[model samples]
Target chain A: MGEPLLRVENVVKRFGGFQALGGVSLEVQPGERFGLIGPNGSGKTTLINCISGTLRNDEGRIFFRGQDITALPAHRRTWRGIARTFQIPRPFGTMTVLENLRVTLEYAARERARAGDPAVEAMEILAGVGLDPKAGAISGLLTQIEMRKLELARAMAAKPALLISDEAMAGLSSSEVDELLEILLRLNAAGTTVIMIEHIMRAVMRFSERIAVLDAGEKIAEGPPDKVVSDRAVERAYLGE
Target chain B: MQARWLLALAGVLIVGAFVVTRTVDNRYVYFAAYGILQYVLLATAWNILGGYTGYVNFGTGAFFALGAYTSVFLIQAVQAPLVVLIVAGGLVSGLLGFGIGYLTLRLRGVFFSIATLALAVVLETMMVNWEYVGGAKGISIIRPSAGPLFTNYVQLLFVVMAALAMGAVAVAWFIEHSRIGRGFATIRDNEEAAECMGVPTLRLKLLATTVSGCLMGIAGAPFPYYITFVEPVSAFNLSYAVNSLAMPMVGGTTSWVGPIIGAVLLGTLQQLATVTISSELNLLIVGVVLVAFVVLAPEGILGLLRRGTRRTRA
Candidate 1:
């Protein structure tokens, strides 16, 4: 009912001749668990990149809590409380895992984190993502799941009102997926809005209150998880009926 | 280390330099030490941008020469004091660094290195044609009288250089331990990720260039007085470019201590080679030592020492 936490209004992105994102639009509410799913090359990543200010959309405007941020640079967008995990983990290789979170805490969350010492706050974030024991480990040498957890923890260090998880569960074991899902669930319950772009159907169906499906850069279906799964177009888009 | 401890260490070093000036009567010793100390300042300046931020600037000589030239101009026009010359030189080169960074930082990797190389060539050409600060033929400077503090002008220069080198190192140490240093590390490791994490990579890179350039320029501000001649060719010597970069690589790129070690070791070696062999062999020494370090310890002497200590502890 109130202004959506994030609104994407008909974004178009073209890489030379090919349109990576073709006029896609979506909205996510405050404290909502939203899922965005598409087959490979359905423009899910492109759309998110546009929303996160990594790739500027050609035609659309983006709003975060009623502020137009479509023209902002990626770092400025981050300063405005939008944090994202890379689809492929991009841990700061030379720094310790704890230092990685410190980067975000010192920069993105500096204004909000006025009371706590950055090291103490960084350790608290690492603990929340279950990476406290590896706090001193070099981030580049972390195991895949640990890197993913570090990525999430680093994102959480921003204290973002909106957290974008992009294929964070990819290449992760099921138990790892469950663990990450639990973290996401807990984060959402504690008043953070989450946009999960995942390929894992079971995780999506279980976690999302509502889901939006993208097919070839278009939103094919969006509704409550059960209704969206049973929709004929959603089935066709996944199974090629 | 805490800033206070670092300041105290600097105080000790300055006192030691003053003692050497008092005790040693040999002028050549001051000459040789001044050369070595200049390298310490230059290499430390280079590492602030090159090592900390992963931006390789091949235009080290350009900034150094600019500072020297700034002094040359001021000396001819206003007969400014050494302090004023140093400040003016730093401001000029700092502005140039910010301008160049704005234009060229958009190009990453080898392209950025090439652009910096081009910058040295461009600056050299300008200096060669500029008549006010002496053209390609060069100009001689009459040495200023040494004040009550020292025995002669060269001794005064030696002490001044030692102070400058210590100040440069103290500044580098401060940056290495601060939030700016952490931001720089992220930019080095992964820039895009750094930006997404809100590190403000572009602004930080500009800050790096300005600070690095200002220090290099400050090191150069005394050169007109030190050498008593200002010329394009010698002022933009190829050895300065090579030594500033090589010293950091040989010492270690990660911390401020590495450049000082590299500069002192390599510089002393080169000074010895110049005395024992020929001055022409200075580059050859740098070449041989750099190759050895790159192959045996690519992380520099500090990295090797760190590995050594870790192994011993284990």
Candidate 2:
């Protein structure tokens, strides 16, 4: 196969003396829908933080499209096409929904020299996710699902090749979950690779083309969803052995 | 381009101040206008960092005093022109601001604020012990004779301050509407998110500090000539810090207009109170009004008005 889009090698993270991620390795291919699953505190978010440059790994090299990205700051990583949504949606509260996306669009345009109106581009991103009607509404006034969509749209505004969505569907109803899933799938179809960190098994099962299960800060299993779901190690990791 | 209106507004306001200077003969009016315009400059300058970046800087007094002292040293040494003093003051304070931001800006929230507070205290102490620039005993400059254009020095000073106030406001307004302002808004909203959105958060923050400090210093440069006396005690007064923060909070911190509204409203009220009551009571009145506004309208008068208009529309 061609070179993978992202490669995480022996990534370890620690808080105080506690090892949150001992040594986890994984690879995601270009244009693939990847799911990172774990029990609570299984180092899923830590790995995401490491990959997205929010937290640097103590011992690891993160490669993006054959380029080492371990030392880059978060914004530099973003400029090079790494974008993520916080597990907790953080819409710019004081800004209107359109303005919220425009912030990212304007930055990306400056970095990459895109020639178009950022406001129009911002509206397009909002419309793509069914948030166009509330373009002028203050972001803080958005409902939970709307905020999640906004989080994704803001990431999209960066025109990132790799998009990470951390717990984007938490606290969402089943229909809302499906709606968000559809949005992600549509984005993937449009040629953006996505890594979805989620607790919702149904959405993860339906969406992922490949799955990596992290347990106790280690990669316990990696395979197709069916095989990984049925594996004894994965089973014991979810429920006590 | 959209900010051209602000320039026009500045022109009108400056002309109006000149008219008042030409028509009104009373020295007190010029004095009062001077006070209002000074706060206008201070509040506008302070808001660039405090309001925009979500970084609260308590060292405004230090920056202001540095500007005033920059003028003092220049006069004692080379006898610089007022314009030269203003430019030098801005550059000097801006450098100090940038240096401080580089060293201490890594500390977030209240810790960063404490660092600035400590900086102000340390600078004040250095000024007290320093032998040059009058040390403990203040220095006074006999007033320069009235300029050919203006009838008196006070009138010229009033016009200068009015022009500075308008210029500061215009600069603040431009930044608020520009892409840099959006980046600042992101930093204020959620810094981590801003970073992930490709905003060079640290650079934007440093720019805010530099510009904010520079404008404040420029405002301070003319202050020595205004008072005709330069003293560490008065130049480093706590009121600069208090009034700068209060004016923005009372007006609204989000937009450029908020600080101007705050400076004018609170500024006018204080001037009135100082004349009718005691000048000491002026600070007390400011204290009381600030508290009332904080408790009643935490977002300031502009925020209150926006909400009121939104409600009426709804």
Candidate 3:
């Protein structure tokens, strides 16, 4: 717990003439519940893309558990125990919900898959995410909320040490958001470190033990939610005042 | 779905086909059989990348022609046996597939497809200019002595083609049920999500392309000997491209059975249409049938059949 679970130092990412992220540095402690809140187009997703290896950073180093992982591919980062959810749910429409979970479990827990039944384990994960009843249902047939649950279940199946949840509550009703928040909290309580990226202020403020705010490709504030809520810079960044 | 069951079924079908062909004792039957089975092989090979992994390979004709020409070159050089020629041809096409996939797989969607289509044109032009294998004038290979396994060359070739088609089906089935197939499914579903979930998408895509190309190339290996001549235009005909793509799309793309069903159904229909009516009408029939399938059942026959069962249950 003394060492950072993930470390990003001076990340700079650009697409052609536009700079998406500029010299952002951050550290996530092991077993920490961290929140990242940002306005639209504020480099939150880009920073995540660097950490997750979706896009390479033009400058900077990213480390996971003291190992330099800036150059690793996305699948390698996942194998190294970093799993992320997408902002938009992307379940395989042709497969059943259980099959979607099996893909992750089969790949990530390859050693476990050698000994145990992936179908049984996939059902267990579906049950965990409260999608057990829809295990056999085609993924495309799922409701919006169910799709989100399947996405989380798929991530959970990877058995990551650090879970980066990207807008898991997007487009959900308040009750659905609470349900998702509870699941995330329960998961964090069970020992997975969480870095939640969200636009939902209420969810972020309530879920975070420590929060970081991003505005226009810069970190505007870093502290507890209440402190960040009162910070002048954070207020000005959010309100553009 | 199971290996043992599939193996057993293949054994029965191979033996059954042999008995039926022998009983027919007609050259036209063997010729028709070979023509139809060729598509069975091509469609199965194309399905590996197209139906399963969802990568459009517009250069199947090039790969097929490459395989045939590889054999022509080998035959001209030392008169290599059909078996050796097939292996050499597959190796050449597999390497080409891998090379082209490496260059273009980075580009997604229509761009990648256009690259493959370009590959076909480039390769065909090279074949046209390169006079070693007679160039555009084409070359003919006299039939070689037959092995002890069969009484006649054509009969032996038919048996070999049948075996290859069955083997291709088996390979596709094995991939469909294995971990590799699941990885391919993930790629087909969503490449980005699959990558973040720990699936190595690029590696799997490369594998599918190589294997698919190799098999398509192998199917073309025996074609020159069967036709006794090879021309650049005929070898690289767009019919190979059209039929291979349409067969799997019309039959189904998601499972091993789809390509076989599509190839057999469409191939047999085309053969009959060619015999009974104008040969040029075959292409129109394929186009119309493909358009109908795309409009009515984009998932193909397997999907359409599943819908039928769903209605009964409801």
Candidate 4:
């Protein structure tokens, strides 16, 4: 699939004597809807954090867009078109919704200064996220779903080609999950590769093009969503079958 | 458009104040204005890092002392122009800021502030023992001529201080409206979120610290000439820290104009107290004002003004 957009090769991460991620490896293709799932303490977040440069891998290489990005700083990785939403939406509480988007827009502008008007680009992003109406509202006062949307909007503001959404629908209801899934589908349709790390089984089954299950920092199964869900190893890992 | 009009009104008022000071022959008025100007610059500088970036700096006295001593050394060594010495002082302080920030920007709030305070104490001790700078006895600067066109150097110094204050305010305003300002706000609010969103928080914090230190240095650089003496006691005085810290806290730590307003009101009151009441009473009043604002009007006078304006508009 056009030389995988992201590749993690034998990545290892440790916290003193405890190994958070032990030689984990994964690849995400361009425009792919990849699902990352595992039980709690399965190193799902640790693997993503290492991929996103939030934590450096103890060993192994991370290649992004055909280049070694192993040692690149988190912001530099973002500039290279990698953006992630937090597990907990952390909007700049003091700023308005529009201003929160504006900060990301400004970072993108600084990186690509020669690329036309920044304010117009910022507004376009807000519109895309369906947050144009509440643009001037204080971010701290936003409702739960609105905050999730803002988290996505901020990730998209950098105009990243690859978007990592970490539990965007964590605390939402079933209907809210569908709403967020629709937004992610729309974003993916516009050619942004998305890696959705979610624990919701039905949503992940519906959204992921390819699913990978991690059990205790190891990839126990990888295949089509239907097959992966039906795999004995996956069932045993989740339900202790 | 509304903001622009407010800025224009501010500009007019500032120019009018300068004109009145220029025309008036009253020394007391100039002295009061000069003192306010110093506090305004110091508080504004402190606000760059403390308010905008959400990094409270307790080392205001260190940068101030650095500028004062740099001015003294340059004047004593090369007899340079006051303007040049001021710039030199600012550059030296900026470099020091860069060095300190590079070493300590990884630290979170209180730890960073404590490191800076430690740096200040260490620097103060070094200056106190260093004999070339009069070894705590202090060095008296001979006031250089301001040319025949202007005879009253105090008035000239007042004008210079006022100009510097205006420049500091202008820079703060520009930063507040710019992208860097927004980035700083994000860093202050949620640093991890900011980094994930592609903000280079470390670099931005360092930039704020450097610029803040430079401005503080420039504010202090003229003190030896303005007061015509420089001693460790006055240069590295804890009062500098108290004034810098209190002014921003009383003004509202959220906006550009907060510190400027706080500095002027508090500074004018202090000067008046020093003249009419005991010198110690001035600090006592500042302490009282600071506590009152912290407890009751935490948003400060400028915050109240902003709220009042918003309420009126609504």
- By DockQ thresholds, what CAPRI class is model 3? high
Write model 1 residue lDDT over B1-314, tens digit each, in one string: 47888799889988899888899999999999999999999999999999999988888999999999999999999899999999999999888888877854578877888887888899999989989889889888888899988899889899889999999998899899899998999999998888888888889999999999999999999999999999999999978889999999999999999999999999999999999999999999999999999999999999999999999999
Give TM-scores of chain A for all candidates.
Answer: 0.98, 0.98, 0.96, 0.95
- lDDT string for model 4 (B237-281, tens) is 888888998998898888877888789889989988988987888
Candidate 2 lDDT tens digits, A6-62:
999999999999999999999999999999998999999999999989898999899
Q: lDDT of each model, Cα atoms only? A: 0.91, 0.90, 0.89, 0.87
Which residue pairs of candidate 4 clash?
none
> Candidate 1 or 4, higher lDDT?
1
After superposition, which runs of candidate 4 have C-alpha atoms over 4 Å from their true positions?
Answer: A109-116, B1-18, B310-314
- TM-scores of the candidates in the order shown: 0.97, 0.97, 0.98, 0.95
Docking class of 1: medium
Model 3, B1-314: lDDT tens digits are: 46898899899888877776567677877888898899999999999988887888888999999999999999999989999989998999999878866854467878888898999999999999889886999998888876775556777778889999999999999899888999999888888888998998888988998999999899999988888889999899988989999999999999888988999999999999999997888889889999999998999999999999999999
Interface RMSD of the candidates, in order = 0.8, 1.0, 0.9, 1.2
Clashing pairs in 3: none
Report the poorest 10 consecutive residues by lDDT, candidate 2 chain A: A106-115
Better of 2 and 3 by lDDT: 2
- Could you tell me the lDDT of residue B108 within candidate 3? 81
